[model samples]
Target chain A: MSKRVALEASHACCEAVRMADTDVVAAYPITPQTHVPERLAEMVADGELDAEYIPVESEHSAMSACCGASAVGARAFTTTAGVGLELMHEVVYIASSMRYPIVMVICNRALSAPLSVWCDHSDVMSVRDTGWIQVFCQNNQEAFDMTLWAFRVGEDPKVLFPVMVHFDGFTLSHVTEAMFLPEQEEVDRFLPKKRQYQFALDPDKPMTHGAFGPPDMYTESKISQEVAFRKSKELIIQGWKEFGKIFGRYYYPVEPYRAEGAKTMLLMMGSLNETAKLVVDRKREKGESVGLINLRLWRPFPFEELRQAVKDAETIVVFDRCISFGGPGGPVFSEVRSALYGMERMPKVVGFVGGLGGRDVPIKDIEYAFDRGREVAEKGSEEIFETVGVRGKVEGIREPKGVYLPAK
Target chain B: MATKARKTKAAVKKLRTASEVTWRDMEVGGILTDAGSAALRRTGDWRSERPILDKEKCNKCGLCWLYCPDAAVDACEDGYYEVNLYSCKGCGICAEICPKEAITMIEEEEE
Candidate 1:
């Protein structure tokens, strides 16, 4: 029997890492993400978990160490938040390109200006093109569950790319929740000892890694990497199915909630999906033709599944916690729109950017967004992207005297 | 028992271009089977100026051998060291480092 315990979600993730029998945990603690490494350190100190717990100097070194560890066939893991993710941005690209199966849990936090350490999807969006498989979690249970699943999927021989498991900082990271922590024996059975890399760094077999490819070979190198990543989606589905069979909890790349026979659907990722689901339920109760599409998989972008999820809908309102600045819409919205671009009966996609810098995107704001999206769809508006929950109208906000603005 | 693995030397004699590369040359995780494949590339082709050795004036002090970055200077059957045009990049480091003034940089004749 599995143990049922109430624990902080961050600790739950740490427990998952322990139960997964991760060989190395190298990370520098950032707020909301600190509890994970902190508990891992305690577990290592108490001799409960036998692993190399490297307290790295910075996020860059943390990721670099993980790259090194994973390259040597160790089941490496790490956790970071906000600026830490940005600091390790360069290594993030290398890790995926080199095909290191390092599992990372990012307690997704808002990026800084007026620095805020709170929940948002901004950090992960910044590295959206890093080629690592990214997954967002809705609650503590999912965070814990995905931590285990990440190692299984990432370490699969067919898919050797790194994986990022994103859970909302503060919201899911700090909140205590009751969930069943799987037994060590079950977890061991589910995830056998990590198999050795076919071309691992070994003294006996000398080989070079991360070599410079000239112009002639660079294109093929990139094509090969992308083909491997795209093909990993099949292995990801397979891995999830295998996990479901053992654990009795199923998950999908894009999960639909009351989306069938609905005209307008709300799309969201991370913990915000829970909030959107509530509004979907409320709207359904009042006979409103509204539903929700929760994006569980963020990378390999789930292009086909996303299109299939909203195929029946007339309007799709995508809630983005991070804006794309000069682009057509938020990151999620841009990807969603691009995914549905060539369809014969494409849904009117509305991009709504809110909950930035950790601001609470209340249930009312989401309801308003759905209604406004429906109105925009009915009107056939050319402009479909807008910001929500931003304070007081900006009629007279000006750039500094020295800063020149380009004439629009 | 840490012996280094070596591929057939005859295969390293000629430089192979990207078009000559086949899928069989590709490895699972970018592994380089032949560790120092740079030797397979005739970097002497990149040389604008070649180093001409005056064997009579050469003292065989071995300074040129020490200074050659690519280790292109091979010790002859006699005491003198000769440049192997197959691998020499003609960096002029050997000419600059030769105390006996036995090496001269001249325009490389293209085939």
Candidate 2:
């Protein structure tokens, strides 16, 4: 039996980590990700959870320590947000390429420049190509459930890649929500005590990991990694199915919310999906054909599921929390567009970048997005993307500002 | 202990050169299961210069053997040090470290 309790999303993640029986917790303190490791440290100190908690000075060392622990066949875990993730950018790739199976919780926060410790997808988007199995959590319950699922899927003999469970900072991480916490015995049954890491660092069977590969071997090595990564999707779905059987809460790569027979759809990821769902409900009540598609899995992207979900919709308004600077719209929008390309019948993808740096996305902004998206789909706009609720006017400068010419 | 040594030797024997192996042949995470597998990789082809030994001027101090980074220098039965061309990378460390100045680095003619 599972107990229902109100917990801050960060603490909920800690509880899941505790139940997972992680061997090592190595992380640096970064907001709003600080509460997760902080609570885990207290649990370790109280002897409630027996694990080695290494309070590293930097996020780079934190991830490096996780690599070491995972290499030695330890179930390692870590948490970071925004700039802390950028600080450990290089090691993040190392953790995946080495197939460490280290689980991480990213409290998604905006990047620096303006310097805000708030919720956004900027941090998570930067590490999109790091080769980790990435997933987004819509609420505290999903956050807790996915952390456990991460360990199970990642540590499976078939899929040894690292996993990153991302939730919006402050919005999901700091907010208190009622979630069901499963019993220890139930979690143990789901994720067995024995871990099968074939290439673990053991003295009895000596082996070399992370060997230098010259040009002759580098491409083949990457091809092997890619093959394994693509194959992990099957096990990921299996893990979720098994978890649902035990926990009664099922999850999917691309989840639909009242998307049946709708002409216009709203696509979103992370905590904002709940708000979008509410908007979808209100639109449906008004006899408007609106639906919501929540992208749960980010890496090993749910391309087939996403296409299937939006196949009937005439237009898809992709609301991205992070911008791609000068590139085509947002990162999610560009990928979604590319995924829908070459199809016989494809919907118009209207991208909007908003809710940046913890800015509140009011119900009216979402409503405007739907209206604007419909209008844009009917009559095309010259702009690549439009910012939602931004208060500014721009003057166009078509020519170069400064130029230097060599003497003739 | 004997079985373990034999198992490692068997793994080493089964190991294929980089050009011969495909992605499917690679171990999980590209881990090399056999220990001391580096000894099987011949790095001697990287050499542009070869080390030559002057036997009469050599003091047989074993400095070349000690200083050779690749362990390419070997001691003969007659106490003379000879460079093993199969493993030498032409780093010239043996020539640089010899006190008697009996070792010389000569540029190799293109094959």
Candidate 3:
């Protein structure tokens, strides 16, 4: 029988790791993500989980230790947020490109200039190209579920690449919610005991890891890495399906809520999906043609799944908490547009950057953004980028008062 | 300097050149087969200059062998030390360390 417990999302992650019997937990402290390692350390100290808890000095050292541990055929794990993730940026690439199968939990936080430690997607967006399998969680239960699933997906013989499971900083990490914690025996049955790596850094059979490739072989080396990552999608599906069979809670790469036959849809990620689901329900009650699409899989992007979900919709209002600065619209909006390209019929994609630097994007703001997107689609407007719920007005701003204008 | 060449042979592993490598040989995750296999790679092409030896002035002090960074210097049966041109980087370290002043660094002649 599964144990029902009320746990903060961060602590739930630690519980999941403990249940999975992770071999190593290496991490440094940062806001919103600190509770995870703290609980993990307590578990290791109290003899609850027999694992090496490496209390690293910096996030860089944490990731490096994870790389070393995973390379030596151990199941390594770590957690970080915002600046800490940025500090470990270089090693993040090394971990994935080397295919270490290190699992990481990221408490997504806003980046600093004014230095606010709050919930946002800037941190994970910054490292999107690092080649790690990245996923987002909407609530505490999903956070707990994904943490276990990450280990299974990453350590599969076919997919030896690293995996990162992200949940919003204070939004999910600090909030307490009821979750079903599976028994250790159940987890052990679901996740394999044998740790299989493409190349083990074992003493008996000596091998080189992260070897320096000359210009002659660098391109081919990257091509091989890409092919391996693309192929991992099959194993990811199989792993999740197997987890569902045991746990009774299934998950999808691109999960849709009330999206059937809706003319207009709101697309977002992380905890905002829960808020958007509420707004979708309210809109439906009022007989509005609106729905919601939660993008759970960010890397090894579910392009085909996403295209199928939004095919019938007339407009897609993509809410991006992170900005692309000088480029087109927001980061998630760019991906959605790119995914819709070459399709016979595509929805009019509109971008709304909001909730930056920990600002609250209330349900009303989301409704307004959706209405604006519907208006834009009806008008057939070429300009489709806007920022939701900004305080003061800017000079010479048009219809949607806070449209993000790229510097001329 | 005369030592018996051992009957038990260690196999010589050659590092594949760019053209010699096939896509199938490229391992996933870029993990290499052998750790520290640089010894299999001949770095002779990195050299711009070659060391010329004056055998008459060579004192057989073995200073060149002691200082050869690439370990290209070998003790000859005739008491003099010779450079294995295939692996010599021609860094001039052997010439710099030679007390007999028998070694000279000269531009490598094109074959």
Candidate 4:
């Protein structure tokens, strides 16, 4: 039987890791993400969980340690935040290429220039091409559910890729919310006690992992990994179906809310989707044809499901928490546009950058997004994306003409 | 080292070389299931200069075998250390380390 309890999102993630019966945990302390490993350490010390808790000096070492643990066929897990994720950026690629089924929960935070410890998608966006299977969480329940699901999905023999579970830093990580906690027996049944690793380091049967690939073999090796990664999407969907069958909580790659016959839709990811859903509800009450699309899966980008969800809508307002610098709006916005580029009857996709670095996104801001999105669809705008709720005039800060020479 | 060499020989017989395999045939994660598969690569073709051993001047001290980075120097049954040209990259470390000056590197002419 599953029991309901209030838990911080970080602690909820740790509880799922415990239930997964992870063999090893190697993590460094970082804000918002610190509570996860801290709680796991306490669980280890109290003999509640039998796992090796490695208190690594830095995020680099933490990920490296996980690679080593996972190489030896151990069920390894880790957690990190903004800067920590950046520090371990290179190793993140190695984990996936080597096909280690290590699970990590990223307490998503803003990248630093002004050094703010807040919630945003900047950290996750940077590692978008790192080859790890990534999923975003909208609330505490999803955080717990996805962390557990990550292990089962990643460790499957058919899909031995690393997984990253992302949840907003202070907004979701620090907030307490009620969630269903399943018994260990049910979890054990879902994820078997014996892990079947196709390749592992063993003295009895010697095998080489991460071997030097010569120029002749490098391209073929990369192509094989690419094909395998793309094929893992089928297994990901199947894993979710099985989890839903047992747990009674179904999850989809792109989940929709009140999207039936809607002409306008708001597409978003992470914890902000919860707030956006409420805004959608209020809009619907006022006889507005508004709907919400929550992007749960980030990688293996769910291009098909996204297209299907917005087929009926006339315009999609994509709210991105991070900017793509000078590029065409945010990363999500660019990909969404690219996906809908050649479609026969595509909807007008408007990009908006907001809620950056822990900035509170009030109801008025989301309402403004809908109004502005429809306006842009009707009368096209010159700007690539509009900033939501930003103070001061952005038009005044123009580049000084002839001061900086143009490249030849 | 001897057991690993034997295992490599056995694995080489059963497995196809990496170049002969396509992306569909490659193992998951590109992990080489057989240990010491590097021996099957035959890197000797990379050699611009080949090491020549003088059997008359050789002391059979085995220093050439000990210093060969690629483990290309093979100790024969008669106790003479000979360079196995198939695996030698011709770095000439064996010639440089030979205490008796029994080895010399000669530039190979294109066939």
lDDT of 1 by residue, B1-111 (tens): 112212233555555766676544555455565666655655465678888889889986888877788877767656677777757877899999888888999887743
Model 2 CAPRI quality = medium
- How far in Å is the alpha carbon of A319 misplaced in model 1? 0.7
lDDT (Cα, tens digit) per residue for candidate 3, span A1-408:
998999999998988898888999999999979899999999999999999999899999999999999988899999999999999999999999888889999999988878979988899889999999999999999999999999999988778889999999988999999889998888988888758765777787888888767666788888888888888888888888999999988988899899999999999999999989999999999999898999999999999999999999988999999977667878999999999988899998888889987789899999888998888777854444777788775222234447696999
Candidate 2 ranges beyond 4 A from true positions: A393-408, B1-15, B54-59, B75-87, B108-111
Error of 3 at A64 (Å): 0.7
> Compared with the true structure, what per-residue lDDT tens digits does model 1 show for residues A251-346?
999999999999999998999889888898999999999989999999988889988888999999988998676677788988998999999899
Candidate 3 TM-score over all chains jointly = 0.91
Complex DockQ per candidate = 0.44, 0.71, 0.62, 0.67
Ranking by lDDT: 2, 4, 3, 1
DockQ for the candidate 3 complex?
A: 0.62
Interface C-alpha root-mean-square deviation, candidates in order: 2.4, 0.9, 1.5, 1.3
Off by over 4 Å in 4: A396-408, B1-17, B44-48, B54-59, B77-81, B100-102, B106-111
Give the top-scoring candidate (DockQ).
2
Query: Model 4, range A30-82, lDDT digits (tens) per residue?
Result: 99798999999999999888999999999999999999999999999999999
The docking category that best describes candidate 1 is acceptable
Deviation in Å, model 1, residue A281 alpha carbon: 0.6
Clash totals in order: 0, 0, 0, 0
* Residue pairs of candidate 4 with colliding backbone atoms: none
True contacts kept of 3: 0.76
**lDDT agreement of model 2 with the native:** 0.89
